[model samples]
Target: MNTLGVTLVLGLLLGVWAQTNIERPQCDSPEAEEAALVAQDYLNAEHTQGYKFALNRIEDIKIYTKPDGDKTYKLEVELLETDCHVLDPTPLVNCTVRPKMMTAVEGDCDVVLKRVGGVLTVTAFKCKTEESTEDICLGCSTLLPLNDTTALDFVHKSLASFNNFNENVTYAVFEVGRMSSQVVSGGLVYLAEYVVVEANCTEDPCVPLNDAMAARGICTAKGSSIAHSVNCQMFLTMMPVIDANVVDVNSTVAVTNSTSAVAPALPPMVHVHTGSLSPKLGLRYHKLTTLHNPELSGLLSAESTESDEVVPVAPGVANSTAPADAGSDSSNSAEVPVVVKKRDVPIVPVVPAPAVVDPIAVVPVCPGRKRFF
Candidate 1:
């Protein structure tokens, strides 16, 4: 073939390749809307802790046709927080968007989807929320609206921790008045200022005091998965003053002096036991067992037995009861005492017992013997 004929064939192949691989901007159509909906569903499912998001609008869409006749959709979509929480079984279409006055959250997502055998599948996605963007720009601390889902969650967690430590009264959260959050190296920290009222019921769905003079208190809580602290103060009326001294001069030179005394007392304050209770304290027990460490299991069991008492275990100190050798003979295994110590106690090293392991049974075989079943 001549060089001209070869050049013509190469140009034709290049055109076909470009048409197959090149992405084309597409107008808003049903296909684009369908892709956006699918992406929205994916986002809502991935987010399990916060309020569910509904598709606000499709920002942009690009379609690419592959050589195998498959199509790829690259989309940018806006999402708005809905009134329903993620845990709620309500569908995103049925959920209504939360208003801005209620601290509504909005997010934008870049989603990539591909159609294989006429089925749409999300290939990749990236999202950025308005709150997160602001947080990153502002750095560290950020103010949160009381009605925000995350803020409310922190408020509830603080109240729960407070109730767990409180001995006399079981209080219920009356209102989440104010909240702020900080991003730390360990986790997010929430500072919540709220009001609590004495509750008639003890557990969840608690009934607040119904009396006209029901006791109310103001509480401030700073908490995270890493640590928790709270302080609550109750209001009280001032006592009446008492006159203790009086002096009177007789006759025309009559002079009088009086002295009044009032009790100097501050309102009662409730301070929670910090660092003892966690938002996920209840779940830690299962995790400790899942670690499969006998020392941890023993420690947990001991802690449960003395749950009423606070025992500080030194960090970086291995348990004295842990087995020295994990793979050892079962017959030689022996029980060891678990030593619990206070924070200031000196570290002590103790020899540990060998771990128990089951022996495998071996099947006996005769040489040159053939068997059929």
Candidate 2:
């Protein structure tokens, strides 16, 4: 062979050897190292939530070089969570958070991450709204047998909107029946804690949710007649001035029950239907009439006056005594006979005669007519 041919063959062999060495390092180098570090940090963070995400696999390395001799590599990797599992019962009100950690760079080595197994997402509240509030301590005195299942849910019932401050909270209260030896017709003794629900009125400030009013009726089962109720349930209707703790400082809800034999009975106003009128009864007078006399009736009518002399009693009338003066002597007066006419049966309250008294006895004991004080 010629000297030139031998030289050309050696140069080609040297070029191929250099290409193989450069490609070997490109498959695994600095960029892959940095990605591995990031994956490690992510796994460490996942461990805090009781899960461990470890790198499963990596592949597909491709290297490219520019005129400036700058090289880049592309790759893929897979990962999986090692230990923890989460179960979610409700999806709407719950959220799922998953660990996300992966990075890519242009350099000698490239790392690709592929997720091997599915992640078990733990469910939690992303947002919760405040609904209502109640002040049960004031009116609730005794506990009653409560059917816990009867309680209504705020969201499902649409009773009231929850405020932003009352999210992700669980609260409850108990009701007891009053104990008494007396056999009351209805079970009257009962106590309950008042719960308050505020309306999320950002849209309609004046009104509350449709279920707000009906909600309490369901809670206490007392619609309009707390008077007959052995138990009462009430919900706060006012928009209370909330404190830093999201509780009302001065606002309260009033609870009432009728069958209670407790110290504090239902207020009198609650019994207004019973027709209690002592306060106004004193202002009225009893009406009286006597044989409907035309003359006496005339005096009560629009025309007669005291100056008009009273007529004498009729001849057949048994009570013919003369009309006495305003202050007359009655001991010397003779009694008059009264005759009562009977009805198909008999009449009642036969009008009594006006009683007369001696004027001198009632007057202060003045000295003899001639004497001076």
- The candidate scoring highest on lDDT is 1
Distance from true location, Cα of 301 in model 2, Å:
99
Off by over 4 Å in 1: 1-17, 21-27, 132-373
TM-scores, in order shown?
A: 0.37, 0.17
For model 2, where is the 10-residue window of minimal lDDT? 123-132
Q: Write the per-residue lDDT of candidate 1 for residues 194-254, one digit (tens) a residue.
A: 6566776544367778765776666676766224566666533212111111111111111
Total backbone collisions, model 2: 28
- Give the distance in Å from residue 5's predicted Cα in candidate 2 to where it truly belongs: 32
- Please estimate how well model 1 matches the true structure, expressed as its whole-model Cα lDDT: 0.48
For residues 1-373, what per-residue lDDT tens digits would candidate 2 score against the true structure? 6999878865654333223211212213454534444533333332222122334343222222323343432233333333221111122112222222111101111121222132211110010111112332333332222222222221111112112222321112211111111123454322222232223233422222345233221122221112212121232322222111112212222222212222221111100011211133221111111112332221121111222444443432211111112211222211111111111123344633224232222322211121000
Reference-based TM-score, model 2:
0.17
Against the correct fold, how does model 1 do in TM-score? 0.37
In candidate 1, where is summed lDDT lowest over 10 consecutive residues? Answer: 282-291
